[model samples]
Target: MKFNIKNRVTLLVSVWMMSFTMNMLEGVCSIPSSLEVFEHHKNVTGKKWAVLVAGSNGYENYRHQADVCHAYQILKRGGLEDDNIIVFMYDDIAHHPKNPRPGIIINEPNGSNVYDGVPKDYTGEATNAQNFYAVISGNRSALSGGSGKVVDSGPNDTIFIYYSDHGSTGLVSMPEGDDIMANDFMDVLMEKHATNSYKKMVIYLEACESGSMFEGILPNNINIYATTASKASEDSWAFYCPDYGLPPPPEYTTCLGDLYSISWLEDSDKNDMTKETLQQQYQIVRRRTLIGYKDFHSHVMKYGDDKLKNDLLANYIGANPSLDENAYSFEPSTTQTRLVNQRDAHLLHLRLELQMAPEGSKEKLKARQELVDEISHREHVDNTFHLIWDLLRDKNNNSTMMLNVRPPGKPLVDDWDCFRTLIKTYENHCGRLSSYGKKYTRVFANMCNAGIYVEQLKATTSQVSIPLTSSSTQTLDLSSIGSSFPTSATLQELELVTSIDEELLQEYGDELHRFGKVQRVFVVSLKDRSSHMLAMTTSFLKGDYQDELRFFRVHKSDVYESQVAVTKGIGKYDVANGYAEIKVVDKVGFSTKGGKVTNSKFLLFHIYLS
Candidate 1:
């Protein structure tokens, strides 16, 4: 204890040497040698398994399948075996009639074909939520179709999952069957963790509002890491669209890939994975996704097990041993320059189809009709939701909250069952919730948060009704109107009929002649429907007159039916406006058999023109 400083230093060195010798002999030490570290790394034994899914089908949704196929190519190049990779795609893009290059799919403009050698483990109707869950849970017996290949991994395995498709708040759509709910998906992951199915897992989800899947719900303690294309309330964009500078071939009208998807895939393609960490890749991807577009971009979000960010990408996706770190580099300029919102991409496809079809041909006619129907359906969905909100407000006297966005780290709803039941109740009363309509799910969540009862929703929805369009089997019943000719009918009188049938002018024929040679009859249906002077150009039309008159339709009111300005006319008729007094003049009948409209009835009205 009284030794000098020099003697103490000598004694400490001798003690350290003795401890080091004992550690070396026992094969354990606080700091290992380089050779020992290399041996430890080499002894790390685990299989890398991946599940790639494209949750949508059709030529318009080509980007999803293309993304999945390109991911497969990357995984394969990274050294993962085919057996360890399970793919679930609708598999309708390659040989589709709209495909410019049959049996070939490309992820970028003039890019190499990614469709080749892609496995069809699940295709067509087999690409569904049930099969997706079964595959992830490794419950092969639960699978109904496809190859029945599941992610049968052990505790030492590393799992990677990539999904690209249309998503809404708290749900991701599948090509067939029900959508995969966030709660249900998390339940499966929790089960996997509870059973010690894997050492670690990573998920890359690309879709609109994909962040909703993991936000506030995924426990960070689980050995799972997730990255989403967008936050819980926004849309992920589609890149390489026909309008972009680096678009697909001239023959292709749809986008080739999604912005978030191509950012990561291209990064993987041009990087040495063994030298890159998950955090680095995520930063690069997030930056590229935001910088690639000028107007539209998504917030790439990461969730769960933050510590896993330090893990090498090679742990989940095998590394390319042949790749030299210096040979590959990530270039920000390589990202897409233009992006289209995923929801609006379908309109681009439809518009392109209409433009390409020969004018006056049946193809052009069909294309035009389809374009009209799509526009109408969108408007109808908007009106339906608005009506639902109005009804809810009337019942609860609450402030408007349908469009409210939850704060970050907050789940869509506190009660998943309430959210799901409300959606079902809405669909049961209204028609099926189309992909576009899925955006209104936030409204449902808001309602659930407000403690809006399902019975109240059912009652409110039952009172709501959507008008039948040209796509519906019901046709207008004009035969009920007596042949009595009113000298002239004001546009005000016709507005009621317009509300009942927006396509009246297009469907009307000789029946109009019975009313007499009409002067300028400015018949305006839904305000945004069209601007063409359809009535003047009809075969039965005769004379032209002055004084353009415009009128608005009246929506049903449980409280009171007050005359409201439904819409304004375009051009000259804009200034000239009037109000129509709605009075049910006659009643028609409707008969239905086997859910098909056998015969239908409609309200008839009569009014005199100035």
Candidate 2:
């Protein structure tokens, strides 16, 4: 059946950022006071285990129920059985929109059909490698004494865990009624008397201001990964809470909690993607995750606490060094103010690398507990914190003042040919970084029109390598979504609002508005690695879709802010070097006008159609 065209009002895309107050005690100490030994690669292998801990009580305030389910399913699919996992549930409906189960599904349901059956926890089987799974299905009062397999599980397991809820400073609040300080979790694992039990543990924590617990405490026997850098409540609104509300209520839309997990899993996958490729995907995933959350924040800010950390980032470095090797070079004095003797500099760097491990929190465990203090005292470590043995000890070497130098690998890649490739790759992996490690900036408007497209969004091909630092702009084509949605005037209006020229402005604006007339439209703003939904208007509007409208999205590698910010600053739209992305929707139909001339109910007079 043919339908009439109607345009509705709607916000096109939603953009938000998370501000965090992270506890960075380890980041400060791990600055590498000397130099690193990257030339000589190292590897530590052992049985791997993953665990997911979820507290889904308040769905309205800290809604992360989907994340809980996603974590469980992924773990099970990855070969983790009932024996190696655990889930904790609270009686109250605080974390989840409504009370929910730990894993949304069971490994093997009682019924023959997979989707037809119910979901269950992983506590049925007992595995060979001491692998186990436990779940605390409701309330925090039970958590204190509820040390299921988590306490008994060895430190060596590759535990990928998550805590989704409200957090202040170092404390992660439990529905049990009180907050569990971040330091408490670290104390459980970092203190040699306790943490030494595990061999290699990796903790992926999700909460607010989680970075605070990291102060002074270095991860040991485990790898520590966090969502943000500092304690920031205002950031969450920008991070996940919608500015207005989600899917406009009665329409609970999806959130961004699983984005990071997806990227992490994909990046680590040995299948079609390499570690390098996966890392690149992380930035995209991270940005997309933020976008989803931003839409959420925009949808639900006024209804609840607006103070929120709207973003997530890797606050801890817990990866173990894969190799150790070095190549020597002495070129001087430009970037650094003071120039030192080439020979002394080389020696200084060598001294520093001797004591420290390059990556991973597993090896750092020994260092954090003073188990290596005996070795540290007798050795003369270089600026990089490398500990030297008795024979090489130099009392005069400065440990506090020295800087950590990275051992030589490949040629210096400051120039674009090499540097751009690497940074761009990082962006592809983490989505937060440009292929190189630069922050992305948004210019002009929310979308960019590269050219007049039809069927596919193809742009004028230019630079092959990303991470390029140059001021350039390209046109995008339209016609894929429709051909007759918005009229010329509507297109002009859209272009003017979005900031396009008069000539092409009207054409683009009308086109966008035409798409905006659909029953419901999903608008995507690709800015700074984040793919956010700008609009979810049930009744689309004529002015919403712009055929050739232009806007830009912020996407980059701030991995810090470069990882999530839409652009550096507001206003200033310098065309130097920037990129933008957008997605639009709409509906249209013919219109006719007629009059009942005879008034007999059955008699119809002249009909006018335009």
lDDT (Cα atoms) of all candidates against the true structure: 0.73, 0.27
Model 2 C-alpha lDDT per residue in residues 1-610, reported as the tens digit of each score: 0111111011001100110112143343222210121111112223334455443343332234334444554454434554555554342222233223332221111101111211333222221112211121112233333334443444443444555444433244454432344434544544422544434343544443334334334432233333331222211221112112221122222232322333343333222221122124334445533444323211111101111111111101122222112211112213312211211222222222223423446544443223222222212112011211111123323332112221222111112122233223323322322100111111000011111111111111111112223223323333222222324323233221221111111113112112222112222223343323221111113334321221222222211111111121112222212222221100011111252111000000111111
Off by over 4 Å in 1: 1-43, 321-337, 466-610
Which residue runs does candidate 2 get wrong by more than 4 Å? 1-45, 91-147, 192-195, 219-234, 237-250, 253-610
For residues 372-475, write the lDDT of model 1, one tens digit per residue: 56665676678667867887887788764487888899888999999999988887766667778898888998999887999998866655543333221221
| lDDT value for model 1 | 0.73
Model 2: number of clashes?
191
What TM-scores do the predictions have?
A: 0.74, 0.32
Give the total clashing residue pairs for model 1: 0
What is the alpha-carbon RMSD of candidate 2 to the true structure? 30.7
lDDT of 2 at 137: 19
